[model samples]
Target: MNRLKLTLIRGLPGSGKSTLAKTLNAVHLEADMYFINKQGEYQFDPKELKKAHLWCQNQCKYYLSEGQNVVIANTFVKHWEMQAYRKLAKLFNAQFSIKVCTGNFQNSHNVDLLLINKMKKNWQP
Candidate 1:
């Protein structure tokens, strides 16, 4: 049997979380994906933020249950934000790991600098 691997990538916008996810050789998931439309356009709704995260988590759990490797990239500004995934890994008996990105690349979502600053200020690590 293949080992079940769960990787959580945390970083600020433009910090290369998504870029890193692509190379991890796992089923890549991200909370922001919930905001993207079928047409591949990103239309984020702040009101749906919680729901988006839940969706991401569910997807991760589904894939992990099937014995697939999964990697998720999200802002994860606070340390507690990653607890749910950690729990899921434990429940599924998957090897879990966390990677933090500190790059300053261009933020594809066009997030406001002020908001990014706010997230940086609240970063647990």
Candidate 2:
């Protein structure tokens, strides 16, 4: 049987987490997908952050249960933000790894550089 793996990609808004997730041949799950409307546009709603994260975790669990590798890209700056996923990986006996992207590419989200720098400073890896 193939080993199941779960990769968590963390970084600032413009740090290239999404880019790395796209390169990996696994289920690419991101909380931002929850904000996408039927019009095929991204509309972020701060109030729905919890719901989005739950959706992401559910998707990861579904994929892992099927013995597939999963890759999640999000600005998980703190360790607490990643604990649930780590526990899920343990539950499924999947290999878990965390990748931190530190690239300085232009942010697709258009977040300000000052905010990005602040995030980097507070980033807990």
Best by lDDT: 1
At residue 43, give the lDDT of candidate 2.
89
Per-candidate total of colliding backbone pairs? 0, 0
What tens digits encode model 2's per-residue C-alpha lDDT throughout 1-125? 87799999999998899999999989999999998899989988889999999999999999999888999999998899999999999999889999999888888867778877787899894
Which prediction has the highest TM-score against the true structure?
Answer: 1
TM-score against native, each model? 0.98, 0.93
Compared with the true structure, model 2 gives a TM-score of 0.93
C-alpha RMSD for every candidate: 0.7, 1.2
* lDDT per residue (tens digit) for residues 1-125 in model 1: 76799999999999999999999999999999999999999999999999999999999999998889999999999989999999999999999999999999999899999999999999999
CA lDDT of each prediction against the hidden true structure: 0.96, 0.92
